[model samples]
Target: MVVAEIAEALDVRTWQLQEAKDQLSEVIETAQVRGPQMITRHGRPRAVLLSAEEYLAMTSDRPDFKEWLLGGPKANLALPESAFKATGEAKVEK
Candidate 1:
């Protein structure tokens, strides 16, 4: 795999698909030590290999939809009086 010299500055290494596949262990080790390792196919970026710790750190704090909705600032909306006045078109009652 051709290691991208430019990516070195970012502490990331780019590996060709075949090279990364052939040396999967090394690639994983590199990701663990150096941050993220980018995998490329035909010179285009296809994926990134990240250490488990890095992956967890990136995803662990994300809240689910319900939690996110509940955690947001409360809205203090005031509905118009007409909104509470139901039209007598429906028969359902509490």
Candidate 2:
């Protein structure tokens, strides 16, 4: 695999994900000490192997959708009462 080119740029270990599957334990150990380990398929980057601590550190404290919207700028506008008005039209015709 063309891992050398990618690894040098990112300063991390690179592995062809399929070829490296047999040595997954070694990959995990390396990621714990060396930050992220890049995984590639068909010589293209596909994923990263990260330690649990690192994963949690990166993902923790993420805001949910409701919290995200609530934290944004408040709108000054209000819904118009006319928006709720019903149309005085017939439901059906013969």
- Give candidate 2 misplaced runs (Cα > 4 Å): 1-6, 78-94
**Model 1 TM-score on a 0 to 1 scale:** 0.71
What's every prediction's RMSD, in angstroms? 5.5, 7.2
Candidates' TM-scores?
0.71, 0.71
lDDT of 1 at 19: 100
Cα lDDT tens digits, model 1, 5-94, are 656666688899999999999999999998899998998778999999998999997999999999999987975555556653444355
lDDT of 2 at 63: 100
Go through the candidates in order and give each one's C-alpha lDDT. Answer: 0.84, 0.83
Q: Give the worst 10-residue stretch by lDDT in candidate 2.
A: 85-94
Give the least accurate 10-residue stretch of model 1, judged by summed lDDT: 85-94
Best by lDDT: 1
